[model samples]
Target chain A: MKPEELKYAKSHEWIKLGDEAVVGVSDYAQHEMGDVVFVELPKVGQKAEKEKQCAVVESVKSAFDILSPVSGTITAVNEAVAADPALLNQSPLDEGWLFKIKPENPADAETLLTWEQYQVFIKQA
Target chain B: MAEHELRRTVLNETERKAGGKMVDFHGWELPMEFTGIVKEHEAVRKSAGIFDVSHMGQVFVTGPDAFNLLQHLNANDLKKATPGKGVYSHLINEKGGLVDDIIAFCLSMDRYLVVVNAATADKDFAWIKKHSEHMSVTVENKSDEYSILAVQGPNVPLMMETFAPEALPLPRFGIVEKDIHGRHCFISRTGYTGEDGFEITCPNDIAVQLWNEMLELGKPYNIIPCGLGARDTLRLEAGYLLYGQDVDDDHSTYEANYGWVVCLDKGDFIGRNILAEQKANGVKRKLTGIVLSERGIPRQGCRIFHEGKEVGTFNSATYSPTLKKGIGMGYVTPPLKPGTLVEVEIRGRRVKGEVVRTPFHKGGAFSKVLYTGKDK
Candidate 1:
């Protein structure tokens, strides 16, 4: 079962919000990518637009465009993600969170897919 | 979410042998890894491995004026290539863009074989054909007519001994007509994996049989069937340049470190004058090697920074299994030395890196020096 705390994007990005939304790749994404060897994340303080490419995740073969889960200003970037990239392979939905963002519009989280909703949404794919 | 799919670039015999993970490369479906990349890579280094290169394109140039036409088309000196010998060449565009990198084999006085990158097969064929209007050479796209598989690494001579025991006596760049599993084929001791190996060319129908036979014979040496994934990492570690990544039409032979194939002394080819000028002068952007000093991978198109100033961009990269570190090749401006300190922008972070003399690691599997007492 997919996690309950995270919301998903059609582009396969996922986010978890407490004070700020922490963004990362979905479990579905990391699964399809086989092994995650590299995570190219944006830096803290960078502005990210919703539905726009924010980072790049390279697998054993090719690179994929990682989209932003919400339009916001990046507050914190997980530095550990760059050192041991295999965390995406082990827990893409959790510890692989790319960066936390202060959303431009807090309502943007409502536009994303909820836990069970994304489960059904991805099921069709 | 979409249904999980296995992308294929080219279906070789090994993928058909059982289950294999395939990936899309330049719109073509090809195998990524078979029998695991680490294991297969080690196999090619220690013993032998067969690679399905059928996805790469092949062209047959024939007619009386073939040599004349090729002299103008490629960056290599066609006259220097003796019959049955192969030479690596580049078919550049009028603007000096690389149409494709190829290994052309002079089969006879009037016939030549050209192998090209799979992604540019159609475009390369059309480009060559369109330009051939002025010459009497007949350009034929024979990619469908044949298949090529490379048996490479240290134990290749022993693995292929059943077919041609005397093949051990052949030189590094040798070619011979031999039989594999009772089928006649053309064998060239040439490769892209920086190894001592043979590239076997035979009809499509007999391709499968030949692949299986080689695997059976290679059993003792622990030869594995490798896919393009490991192939890319292997070539990169050897300090070799890939056509699409490290080079393209936007770059020149000298800039790409492929000036060796230019043969400036052989009169003039299409890009000869331009290459000569560049050699006498110097190329603008130069292809150089980079080692990631920090913990991060520097991939294709990543910006190279010199003290926070953008210098150049990376062409391609990977976490090298041999080096146990991230290494890549890329184009750079002046002032970047083999050990020059640089930074690669990974995500938004300026990851520390250093320029290194090409070939992050030695060819432990292909070169003779790496092998011990025997024919290795």
Candidate 2:
């Protein structure tokens, strides 16, 4: 997923908006995490702030926090992510999307990233 | 320090490709593992596996006072160590907690070698050097001079025969004196995986050749490369304690279930009197093993419960490939014994378990097995 289609945070979170804004971690973050096992998703209707930690992802050997990419009220979550966390390893961009939210301000994500900008950001990382 | 990617001398470039999932450990990047933990773990149990253990630190302590240096630094007695033999001991600070657990080997009458945990190597070396200045001893960090590989399993030695059969004649815990494939090599019959295996060390230049040669030689046997992923699970299955996670400088050997190595009978040494007094008075805490009776795996730092209250926390945990159950090691209030019922909190639920002996080796150490049964 291009960082431009979604917003990104320096903390490694990325968000994609379609129907509802979907949030997940970046490829850079996943690579650094090494492996993906368990993911702790925030409950439905939880309010989240930009760059705030909203969920947790666990690998076989490690556990890490997932920061929210855009401030919003979570409306629905991908239950499949929790049932089979390996989705992150398989298709991190499509079926692997984490949770959904009805953002208070969708435009607020404008400052997050552009496709080219995220590439530069990742290189800098 | 996190500039581009962290790299350290603990592991080499070839080791990075061996499924190390490189992590920055004390300024060095080393593989945590290559394949998934469960599969890699079972490989060591049922067959043979290789571990890139280059991250471990090797330090040389020499001079006339080398014996005196070891006596003052380690909690265990080193005066009885004969050449070519090694003994496990605790490197400790004044407070009696362990700085690191190390293997001290007597290389020669005046030369000694100490193998320490990679993360604590600098601290152990610095501490050894800082204290040795007044004792007429000199410490040199030899970590950069070598790369290590631990070929472990039931058939490691048998498999090594194809590559270097001459090493087979060396006794258990024996160290070879020559080079392998033209590289300076030392092979010792010891391993962290609780197997009858060798920790092979050689000059960095020949590491790749030796690894390739071992692979070629081991091809007939299905020996696969293992990473730290399997390494941890194997050690956990064997009930070995990791330095930073399972123990620290704040915990003494008396409390960690290693009193036999303390050797209080051998006159005064660092922490000897304290260990003796602790032994007499009974240490306040003890490290014990646990086998969970629930489905969930108990992991590190998980709170351990006894009855209703929180009593301890698991230091390390894993699902044993042999026992096929969740097992762990942790420190608990003293008087804890085998069959003592306890619980490990996993995802907020207290799973039932019982304290067991240090290690319950299923079918003996994984490497010592020789299949007399016909290949099925």
Candidate 3:
């Protein structure tokens, strides 16, 4: 499902705001990285600065960094995806969400690309 | 960092049509996977798959002194590759480091064909040509003139019989010149995946047609178009050494576990003195296979540890589809014994692994027939 409700980052991370913001790599990112075999999640309460590397995603061919989409503290990490990284490739939007971050400034989420902008950004890439 | 422009194989269009994900491999736009790495890998292990190996280089040495020239350059016994047969050998530098590993086919009394890695093609050609200056042989690089398609799997023989009947009965290490799709091609019963298969080399012009026809005929056998990703995984499961990855210019045959391919009694050859010395004294480091016991996948350059101390580094690693486990090879100091516990550092985390006897999954076609004496 292409979630227009979620804002995306230029680095291919997606974020949806609520009580806490959910973070995950974009669908395009997961498709490009083929068969994710492992995911390194940040610990709960770990501080993450926007645009910084907070997690790792690895595939058979190579490894990729999952950049934090917003300045925040990781509140919860989805262990299911970590246990089976293929979840990222299979469902990058919902069940594959990586971590929930309590944003340092909730308004910072607006700085990310909107669904329309992300679609345009990937087209340009 | 290189300056060369990317080149495409003759099957570039065909691969794209087959749903290949193209990637840059040694300045060549080759498919890394067609369907998916795991799927393509499974196809070859369980059924059949085809690969476009057009990027690999081929050098022909022809003259009455061809055998003598190859004998001087190759570490193995060139005489063993009598006409219609091929021998896998290492081209070593004077310091005993590998220049490149090759399969030299003895086409006749005066001609030989040496297939080399795509990345080292030019370098290998220059090295071979430089050594042939004083000999009676003529070295010719025919990489662009021809294209190679590797049809490998357990069902490869059956598929080959349907596509090209004349190419059959070619035993392991056997080479036969036959017409494929009305084009003269050399079908060799040799493959990197440890499968009983054929590597058909045909002129560039006829390559696309032949590839299409082979896939069409192979439809009933569940043949799929595979790419480099599956190729790497399959070769790793089979314990095949990859040039520039598993073995390089810094390691000799003995250190790389290729001592059997190096014939110390074969008079003289490049690196013979150093290899002889190394064989006598034994190597400081030996290549060994590592299999992960956990979920983490070991990758190339991952630091290897034994009881928290760094022991070595992975040369080439992959998740073996055949074994359903992570398998890799690395050179370690004081070589670890088979079944010795080790850890691979992946993304700063040490994953549990164990050193095991190689060809991790022994069910491959070639391994079954050649190594275990169990015909499939």
CAPRI-style grade of the A/B interface in model 1: acceptable
Pairs clashing within candidate 3: none
TM-score of chain A of 2: 0.87
Q: What's the i-RMS of each model? A: 2.5, 3.3, 1.2
**Which ten contiguous residues of candidate 1 chain B have the minimum total lDDT?**
B365-374
* Candidate 3 residue-wise lDDT, B1-376, digit = tens: 8667889999999899888999998789999998788888888888889999999999999998999999999999998999999999999999999999999999899989999999999999999999999788899999999999999887778876656565565568889887766777888988888777789989999999988887887888899999999999988898889998888889999999879999989899999999999999999899999999987778889898998888899999987777766788999997889989999987787889999988876545555353212244
Error of 1 at A89 (Å): 6.6
For each model, chain A TM-score?
0.92, 0.87, 0.95
In terms of TM-score, which candidate is strongest? 3
lDDT values for all models: 0.77, 0.75, 0.88
**lDDT score, residue A26, model 1?**
85
What order do you get sorting by TM-score, best first?
A: 3, 1, 2
**Runs with alpha carbons beyond 4 Å of true place in candidate 3:** A44-47, A73-75, B1-3, B368-376
Model 1 over residues B124-196: C-alpha lDDT tens digits?
8897788789788899998877788888887887766666665555555556767655666678777777777
Candidate 1 or 3, higher TM-score?
3
**lDDT (C-alpha) at residue B169 in model 2:** 61
At residue B353, candidate 3 shows an lDDT of: 94
The value of fnat for model 1 is 0.31
Point out the higher-scoring one by lDDT: 1 or 3. 3
